[model samples]
Target: MTLSFFDQFMSPVLMGIPLMFLALTLPWALFAKPSPRVLNSRMVALQTWSIMGFVKQIFQPLSTPAHKWAMILTSVMMFIITMNLLGLLPYTFTPTTQLSLNLGLAVPLWLATVILGMRNQPTHALGHLLPEGTPPLLIPLLIIIETISLFIRPLALGVRLTANLTAGHLLIQLISTAAFTLISIMPTVAFLTGLLLFLLTFLEVAVAMIQAYVFVLLLSLYLQENV
Candidate 1:
């Protein structure tokens, strides 16, 4: 019974090959291609408008030097949000829910920011480890604590995204299962549960988008500190 709830998280297989790649690429295919005409389709125009707004909001707090990452960051946010929202659909897989995939995305970007900081301003980067005017007795301990905190950033990023999505999915699954089971025995209770499920589903959709934004926003903040 427990396994039934979590089994959905496993990547679906077709002819012994994982379909995770297909799930990742399907979001791109869902968007309408731009036409070579003067006027575009309403869907294409809406997508373009949304993307432009997102890019502007993301780059607003970034420095000019960091603006070069605009494309990569925006693409990542879109990919994550798409996967998250798609997973809400029946029988769809979410790659971002996997800790491995989340970590893969988080670590490289986080490390790039850290490495950029070290390369461009080594003194400033290292200075984060030890504060000014610290007593000689507590300097070493403070440095150790700060160093640990610095290295934990990428892990925090990966775990935060994974945990939030996983928790939401689990709650939805549990409530849905209970509602289904109660339909025959207690129709009224089941109806109420279904209503609750409806509200939860909407909240989960918001969470899906917000989590993607937050993940990208944190990376930008990290880049801001570095650049």
Candidate 2:
């Protein structure tokens, strides 16, 4: 029974074929594309305005060179937000809940910033490994520590997103199970539990949006340092 609770996180399969690809593509369909005509529908207008705001905020701190990444960053942010929110609906699979998927997204973007730094300003990039005016004895230790931290960034990014979403989903499921079980035996308690569940669902919605923003914000910060 306990294992069944975790089964929701597993990629759904049909005839032995994993449907993760479908889950990944499903969220994109919900977003309305902009129209070429002069006037646009309210849905398209809202999407356009919100995306513009996010793009402006993300690029505000980044250099001109990093501005080239605006489209990619915005798309990823929207994708993650959509996936996280969609998972809250009945029978929907969240691609972001998978650590492998999160890591796949994180590693490439982090590596891109690192590579950009190295290619554009090798000296500046390497300088991040050791601080200036370091004592000779501490130089080697600091360099090793910084290097380790540098590589760990992607891992941290992946783990953070996975852990938060997984924990929230587990809690929601647990609370829901309790609510359903109590509905007959203890009507009052079940009603309160249902109320709590509703509130938790709202909080999770905010978390879904916040986590996506945080993920993109951190990536932009990394880009800022490189550019």
Q: Which model scores highest in TM-score?
A: 2
For residues 86-136, write the lDDT of model 1, one tens digit per residue: 999987887888999999999999999999999999999888899998999
The prediction achieving the highest lDDT against the true structure is 2
TM-score of candidate 2 against the unseen true structure: 0.97
Model 1 misplacement above 4 A = 1-3
Q: Report how far off residue 174 is in candidate 2 (Å).
A: 0.6
- Supply the global lDDT for candidate 1: 0.91
Q: Which digits, one per residue and each the tens of the lDDT, describe model 2 over residues 1-227?
A: 35788899999999999999999998899999888899999999999999999999889877799999999999999999999999999888888899999999999999999999999999999999999999999998999999999999999899999999999999999999999999999999999999999999999999999999999999998898888
Error of 2 at 59 (Å): 0.7
Give the CA lDDT, 0 to 100, for residue 189 in model 1: 100
The global C-alpha lDDT for each of the candidates, from Candidate 1 onward, is 0.91, 0.94
lDDT of 2: 0.94
Q: List the residue pairs that clash in candidate 1.
A: none
